[model samples]
Target: MYIPPSSTSPSAQTTTIMSLKTALISYFTFFVVFVDLTLASKHHVINFRSPTLYPESLTWDPSADHFIVGSHRHRTLVSVSSAAAVDTLISDLSLPPNTTIVGVSLDHHRRRLLAVVHSTPPLPIFNALAAYDLRSPHRRRLFLAPLHDPTTDRPIANDVAFDFSGDAYVTNSVGNFIWKVTPDGEPSIFSRSPAFTSHPVDQSLPHSFCGLNGVVYSRKRLPPRRPIKHRQNVQSQRR
Candidate 1:
C-alpha cells in the first residue's frame, strides 16, 4: 500500500516564508540602489557642430560662463556655450597663415588669455606664445614671445601653463623641454631632463617622436618659500 508524505510543520513553513521575504527585500534593495547609482552617474553631452573647426584644447571661463577652445584648422579662438552657440572670440590676423592654435590658458587675475601657436610638419617654421587682453573690447593682442630653442631643429610649442607670478611655462613636444616666459614677454628654457629623452616610445604609434606635450603649475606642490636645499634634497631622493 502507498503512503502519503508528511507535510512541513507550521514553524518550518513560517521560517521558509521569512527566508523568502528576506531574499526578496535584499533583491529589491539592490535594484533600487543600482537604479540610483545609474541616475547619479548619468552625464549630459554638449555637441559642437562645426565640421571644419578641429579644436585642439579647451578651457572653461568662469567669468563668461563658456568654454574657450583653440582651433587647429581655423587658427582661431572660439567661445562655445552649453547651448551650442559657437562664436569666434579671437581671429588674430597676426598669426601666420595656416598655423594652428594648439593650447590656450586663461588668466582671470590678469585678464589675459595665453595661446600656443605653431606650424605643423612640411614646414614647421613658427612657434610662439601669444597673449590677448580678455577684457579689451577688441580683444587686443598683448604680446607674442617667440619660443625657439637653438638646440631643437623642429620645436613645437604644444601647451602652456601660467604660474602665480604671471609667468608662463610652455612645453616643446619635439625638444622635450619647458620654456618659461616672464610677464615682460621674455622667453627662456625653464627645465630639461635626460629622462625625458630616455622614456621609451612605441615605434608603432603615430607621432611617436613627440614628447613633453603638456605642462601644469601647482603652488601647493612646491611652495615659493621652500628652501632650495630642501627642494634639491627632494629631487635627489626621487631620483
Candidate 2:
C-alpha cells in the first residue's frame, strides 16, 4: 500500500513500491539503508561507518571516485568509498591535539588537498590552513600556514576556496575576513568588508558571532571598458 513519489508509468510505479518494501524489510532486519532517488529510473543506497567521526565538510574526488570528508571530532581526513569503506587519508601530528578539521577542498590540477584546522572557543589555541600532497604515497603534509596573528583576537579558520592561479582563500568565521595563502605557503589577510560585520536585527539568533563560513572563486572575465577615444569625445563635447 506504499505510494511512489513520482512515476512516468504504472509499471515503474509498481517497481518503486516493491523496492521500498524490500528496503523497509531490510531496515527492520538491522541493516542501515537509504534510498537515493537522484535518477528517476535508478535507486541506490550507501551506508558508511566511522565511529565518533562527525564530519563537517565533504568534497568529491572524481579521480578516486570517492568522497573526501573532514572530521569534526577526530581531527582527521577520511575517504568514503561507494562500498561504504572508510580510510584515513590525512592525520598530521604537528597540529594541536584538540583542533578539528573544518573544511576540505581538492585541487585536482595541482594534486593537493586543502584543509582548514582550528580550535573552538573557550581557550582557542590553533588556527591554520593545511595542505597535503595527494600524489605522494604517504600523503605527505605539504604545509600548514597559521591564519591569525598571535597578538590579534582568536579567529576560527572555517572554509577554503582555490583559484586557478594556485592561491587558496580561507574564511574566518569569527573575525569576519578572508585569508589568502600563496602557492609557497605564505598566509595573509586577503579581504574584509564592513558589510560582513552587519548582523541580523534579531540578536537572539544562534551563532551570530560566525561570519563568512564558505567561499568560492569564479574565472569569468568582465567586459572590456569603452575605448579612451570615446571618453575623449564626450569630454570635448562638454567643453
Candidate 3:
C-alpha cells in the first residue's frame, strides 16, 4: 500500500499523491511475469514477452494509428495496432522509485497521461497514480494525484482516467473509492463498486479493477481545445 507524491499543476493548483517503492515484489509474495496471446492469421498465433500488466486505461489515436497500453513500473506506453508492437512510447513522469504502472491512454489529443504505479514511502514503497507528459516521452515529470500528505507523508493513488467529457477519475485505494475530478476544480464520487474494496490487503494482485484497460480518442475528433480545464490554464470560467 505505497503511494507516490506528484507536483501540483502550475495552473491546476492542486496536489497529487505518489508512491515510494519501485519493485513489483511489494504487492506479491513471489515475483511473477505476465503472458498474452493473439492470433494474427487464421492459422497462426504469436506470443510475446509483455510486462506484468496493470491495465489503467487505453485509447487509440487514428492519427498515430496505434493503441497505447499503460501498466506498472515503466514509463513507456505499449504502442499496439492490428499488426503488432510498433514501439514503446516513453513518458515524462517523476514516479516513485521502483514503481510499476498498470494504466495508459492512446489519444492524439490531450497532454496529461495516466497510469497505475506502485511504490512504498520512507523506503521506496508505494501504489498510486503515475502522470506523464504527452509532448515529452519517457521523462518522469511529476505526480498529478499524490496520496500521502507532504506533512503527514502517508497516502497513495491507485489508478486514474478521464471520462468522455474529459473529467479525470481516479481510484483512491486508501479511501477505498473512485473519484470523479472535474477539470473545473471539482471532485466527486464516480464509482464505489464493492470489487474495488474487496481487494485483499496482502501482497495480493488486483483481479480486474473493472475495465482497468486503455482509452482511445481519434485525432479527427480532437476537441477544439486541448482537454478543457485539463491541459490549459487552471483558471477556467465555467459555463
Q: Which one wins on TM-score?
A: 1
lDDT string, candidate 3, 1-239, tens digits: 43333544633333222222323355443333221223332363333346655445566666666667765545556766656654676543555455656545432355656665556445564544445566665534444544332322433455566656666666554555565655443555666678755644544556332332332233365558545465345445342
Return the top candidate by lDDT: 1
Compute each candidate's TM-score over C-alphas.
0.76, 0.73, 0.45
- Regarding lDDT, does 1 or 3 come out ahead? 1
Could you tell which candidate, 2 or 3, scores higher by TM-score?
2
Higher-lDDT candidate of 2 and 3: 2
TM-score of candidate 1 on Cα atoms, chains taken together:
0.76
Residue 215 of model 3 has an lDDT of: 28
In each prediction, how many residue pairs overlap at the backbone (N, C-alpha, C within less than 3 A)? 0, 0, 68
Q: What is the C-alpha lDDT of each candidate?
A: 0.89, 0.85, 0.51
- Put down candidate 2 lDDT per residue, 47-111, tens digits, no spaces: 89999898899999999999999988767899999898899988787788768899899999998
